[model samples]
Target: MEKKIADALSEIDGAGRVTVVLTMKAGSRRMLAEETNNDDTSAVLVSRGSGYQETVTVQELSPQYQGALVVCEGAGDPAVKLKLVEAVSALTGLGSNKISICKGK
Candidate 1:
C-alpha cells in the first residue's frame, strides 16, 4: 500500500521521491447478496467447473482509512501539499484533516 501511494505521488510535478504511510480504521470487507425465491431468501451461489460451487459476491469494500502521512521533497510547496492531500483523500477516502504532508529528503 505504501509503495502504491509512493509511486502515484512520484508522478506529481516536483514531488520527488515520495513516501507514504497509511493508517487503516478497519480491514477490507465484503457483502454477500442473497437470492429470493418463493418468498424465501438464501445466499447466492456461483457454479464452477467440475460441479464446484461458491458463494456469489455482491460487493467488495475497501478498508476504512484512519489517516495518511506523506513525505516528499516538494511538500514544502503549497501547491504540492494541496495536490498530495487531494490525491491521498481520493485514494484512501480520507479527509484533508486526516492527511499530513511534510517535506522530507
Candidate 2:
C-alpha cells in the first residue's frame, strides 16, 4: 500500500520523491458466499469437470486504512499538499482529517 501510494503520488505535478506511511485499522479478510440449508452451512461449490468441486469466491476485501502520512519535496506548497492529501484519501478510503501531508528535505 505504501509503495502504491508513493508511486501514485509521484505522478502528481510537482510532487517529487513522494513517501507514504499507512496505518491499517484491520487486516484484509475474504468474504465467501455460503450455502445454508436448514441446519447446514457450507461454502457454495461449483463443479468443474467430472465432479471436481471448487469453492466459490465472492470477492477479496482490501484492508481498511486508519490514517496516512505523506512526505513530498513539493508538499511545502499548499496546492501540492492538498493534492497529496486528497490523493491519499481517495486511494485509502480515508477522510482528509486522517491524512497528513508534509514537506520532505
Candidate 3:
C-alpha cells in the first residue's frame, strides 16, 4: 500500500500537484507536494489543531500534473501519516479508495 502511494506521487508530472490532510489521535497535519520533474522538488507540510480537532493541509498543483487532494484519519503515527500521503498521491491516477478533491486548478 505504501509503495503504491509513493509510486503514484512519484508518477505525477512537473505540472501536477497533490494535497493530503491527515487526522490523528494526537493531532492533525497537512502535506502538499508539487511535481517539478526535478530531483530537488519537495512537498510542504502543515499542521493544525490537536487530537480530534487536529488537521493537515497540503497543496500540490501545477499545469503539468494538475491538482489533487486526499484526507485520512487514524491514530498518530509516523508510518500512518506517510501511508496517507502515499495513498492520496496514488489516488491521482488510480482513483482508488474513492479519494479525490475537486477544487481549483
Candidate 4:
C-alpha cells in the first residue's frame, strides 16, 4: 500500500503538488471535531460496523495546480498517520508546507 501511495505521489514531482495521508480512530472525538470544516479537499471515512471505524484524509497543498488529486488509504489506525506524513514528507522533500487532514464525519 505504501508503494502504491508513493508511486501515485511520485508522478506529481516538480508539478507543484503535495499529498498527505491520515488515519483516525473510530468515533474519535478529535476526528469529529476536525470534520466540522470540510471544503475543497479529498477525504474518506470508512466504517467496519456501527460506528466510525477509521478514516483517511488526503489533501493537496498546491494552489497553482488545481487538478491535483489527493489519495487516502484507510488503515483503521491513527498511529500510522504520523508515519505516513513522515514518509510523504521525506519522499517529496516538502517540509512544513501547510498540510492538514480534512475534517470528516
Candidate 5:
C-alpha cells in the first residue's frame, strides 16, 4: 500500500524520489465464522481432476490510517508541501495534521 501511495504521489509535477511511511492505529485481522458438517455415513469415491482449484476472497475493513510521513524532492516549498498534504488526506481519509511532508534527503 505504501508503494502504491508513493507511486501515486510521485506523479505530481514537483514530486520526485517520493518516500511514504504509513502509520496505522491497528493492524487488519481476519474475521471468523462457524461452519458445521453433519454427514456421518462413510462412503469412498475417488475422482481425478485435470486442473487445480483455489478459492480466493477479498474482505473490506474499516480505516486504520492514523498518520503518515511523506518525503520527496521539492517538498521543501510551502506550496508543494501543502499540496502533498491535501493529496494524502484525500487518499487516506485523514486530516491534514495527520500527514507530514518534508524534503527528500
Candidate 6:
C-alpha cells in the first residue's frame, strides 16, 4: 500500500523520489472458536472438549492506520507539500493531520 501511494505521489509535477511509511494503531488479530475431536488422534494430542481454535479471519476487519510519513524532494515547497498531503490523505482515507510531508534528499 505504501508503495502504491509513493508511486502515485511521484506523479505530481514537482514530486520526486517519494517514500511512504505507514504507522498502524495495532497489529491484526484473528478471531477464534472452540472445537473438540473425539478421534483416536486425541489420545496423543491434548484432548480438550472445548478446545480453543483459530477461525478464518473476519472478512470485515481492516487495518486501522494511525498516520503516514512521506518524504519527497518536492516536499520542501509549500505548494508541493500541500499536494503531497492531499494525495496521501486521499489514498489512505485519512485526514491531513495524519499525514506528514518532509523534504527528501
| lDDT of candidate 6 over 1-105, digit per residue (tens) | 889889999999999899999998865565433345664332123444688543333344456789999999988889999999888887777799999899988
Please estimate how well model 6 matches the true structure, expressed as its whole-model Cα lDDT.
0.80
Q: Which of 1 and 2 is ahead in TM-score?
A: 2
Q: Candidate 4 clashing pairs?
A: 35-103, 35-104
- Top model number, lDDT: 1
**What tens-digit string does per-residue lDDT give for candidate 3 at 1-105?**
334543454344321333343222232233545445557764443454463332234543322223334433331344544554455654443333444433224
- How do all the candidates rank in terms of lDDT, highest first? 1, 2, 6, 5, 3, 4
lDDT of 6 at 97: 91
The lDDT of each candidate is 0.91, 0.91, 0.40, 0.39, 0.79, 0.80
- Candidate 3 deviant stretches above 4 angstroms: 1-69, 93-105
Q: Please write out the lDDT profile of model 4 over residues 17-43, one tens digit for every residue.
A: 324343322222232213445564434
TM-score for all models, in order of appearance: 0.81, 0.82, 0.22, 0.28, 0.68, 0.67
RMSD of 5: 6.2
Q: Which 10 residues in a row give candidate 3 its minimum summed lDDT?
A: 21-30
What's the C-alpha lDDT at position 91 in model 6?
Answer: 77
Candidate 4, residue 98: CA error in Å?
3.5
TM-score between candidate 4 and the true structure:
0.28
Top candidate, metric TM-score: 2
Provide the lowest-lDDT 10-residue window in model 5: 39-48
Off by over 4 Å in 1: 33-44
> In lDDT terms, how accurate is model 2?
0.91
Stretches of model 2 off by over 4 angstroms after superposition: 37-39
